[model samples]
Target: MTHHILKATKENVHLGGFSHLLEPALTIDSGDTIDVETYTGYYVYDKAPPEFLTPEFVDICQNLPPERKIAAGPHLLTGPIYVKDAEPGDVLEVILEAIAPSLPVGFNAIRTGWGALPQQFPQPALRFVRLDLVHNIAEFPPDSGIKIPLKPFFGILGVATPETARTSIPPGCYGGNIDNRELQTGSRVFLPIFVSGGLFSIGDGHSAQGDGEVNVTAIETSMNGRIILKLRKDLQLSTPVAETSTDIITMGFAQTLDAALEMAVKNMIDFLERFVNLSAEDAYVLCSLAVNFRITQVVNSPQKGVHGMLPKSIFSHKINL
Candidate 1:
């Protein structure tokens, strides 16, 4: 019922996403509205070199990183907000209300040894992309006449566990950088709690990205977002799950495509068992009949993810939860 506005400050951000001992930036109870501001990974650490940078942009980039550790996967994450009543066994339900560009320009790049077709692009390359926010279009190369529709969303939204620290470059059971394009406005993510109070974090905004993120980047940009954080104490979750207007999604990640697919299938069956009155055998049959598996992202290092999308209309009755 209360609104918590956290204006992104130098101290309010972490360079790489979640860490084992992240300090909480804000603490609030369930049913609270949160207004958050964040920056893209490149904004905080990988500023354009002096030769290619404009004076204005250089100034903006310099103002960001004196306080944090400069590292890769520099998602410029905001917060490890501790939600009241959210313990290790509960679920943190996040409803994304708005995700928009905070700056006038965004960017995209292909590193020397990265991207889906690294061999084709043997050297590093970068470009400053321009976005027309009022018209909802992104113009690459400034005047390339190529206009891409802007569909902004955070690439990272997750909570931390009590285990050893990890990089923001991987998406796993805790949901760091899933990069699923369907996580637009009106979508909601359900993250499983790990440490007590559920230290939820958010960052890595992208104006638009394709399914595979083949280039290893999208319209990389800073964003301002608003969400409703509610603790789902009655139910427990094994991995991150989400609901878009048309589909219910289960997120799964692992080191290989085979492992990721297996996890996705298992999560799908588990979801059916949790939300429906079906036997285990029946749930598996239902998955085979109506579910679709999608690769969330392949760019995140060491781990990849798949999402099992079950159409909302598949259920014969309304979900009681």
Candidate 2:
């Protein structure tokens, strides 16, 4: 089958929030794969393109209406794709095939009213990162020589719900702006259906990020990536569940850390019981001994998240089935 590619354009992109009422820019059948291009998290605030930034991305930012920059959001999302046969209660399997830089540069920012240490940082600062695509390194300063490996991934991949438009900042059951780095290439994300067609949308690409995302940003950059969307009617999920190269992960979002942690643990327990065939007691015990819970991020207000990780190495039997 031919690969369907969708380029990111001002017409097809949105700022904050998602709703099923928004029209789908593209539609594809189940089991079809699509190539999607996305913008960085700073697309809204970009007044001038950096030296290493590409003209193509600058053109996209320039096309946005002035008011959109104010009300839309900082993150520029690509599309609300209509997947054929996707309906509420079904699961949408998003298989991430590839993630590559679309621009020669990326960026990181520190701003007032943003980041985990907002009180300490009252001023906004922006720093450009030179992406050495060949070397797979994100150089901090050409002279300082600070460098980190490239691990590109889209920060947002969500399905719209039947409710009003939801902001793209905080990730929830719909899967918007979940900055889990594990959702990189070779990962498979399963999102619960909330509306017909799943009204899928994705954007906010990141080159690298740590566990907490405590600074409130990653190697923020634009990217071109491919994903295979498959409709799974036989499965049901509440929040986003994913299997990475090394582990099975379950996610949860809420206002408080305690709540988020509880969500992750409970989801892990459910997964263990359902797939691993462990009894509730056994799963609970195993979780205490094996499951690793991590705070995804604390920056997204009222929607901090945690993910429970169960390593695949523990099982001698392959989980391929």
Instruction: Give TM-scores for every candidate, taking all chains together and pairing residue i with residue i.
Output: 0.90, 0.93
Model 1 spans > 4 angstroms off: 41-72, 141-145
List the candidate 2 regions with Cα displacement exceeding 4 Å.
41-56, 65-72
Question: What is candidate 2's lDDT per residue for 1-321, written digit by digit as tens?
Answer: 447888877666666768777767689999888988887644434553565345656666667544233234477777888998888999999999999988777778776787788988878887777788899987666767778889988888888887766777888988888899888899999999999999888888888888878877887888899999999998878878999989999998998889999999999988888788889999999889988899888887768889999999999876641
Whole-model lDDT, model 1: 0.80
lDDT value, residue 96 of candidate 1: 99
lDDT of 1 at 26: 91
> What is candidate 1's lDDT per residue for 1-321, written digit by digit as tens?
889897666667777656657668899989899999776644423554333344433443566554454346657688879898788988899999999988867778787777778898878777877778899998765678888899999999989888646678888878889999999999999988988888888988899998878878888887889999999988788888899888989977988778888999998898888788677799899889999998888778778778899998966777544
Top candidate (lDDT): 2
Report the C-alpha displacement of residue 136, candidate 2, in angstroms.
0.7
Worst lDDT window (10 residues) for model 2?
64-73
Clashes of 1: 1
The prediction achieving the highest TM-score against the true structure is 2
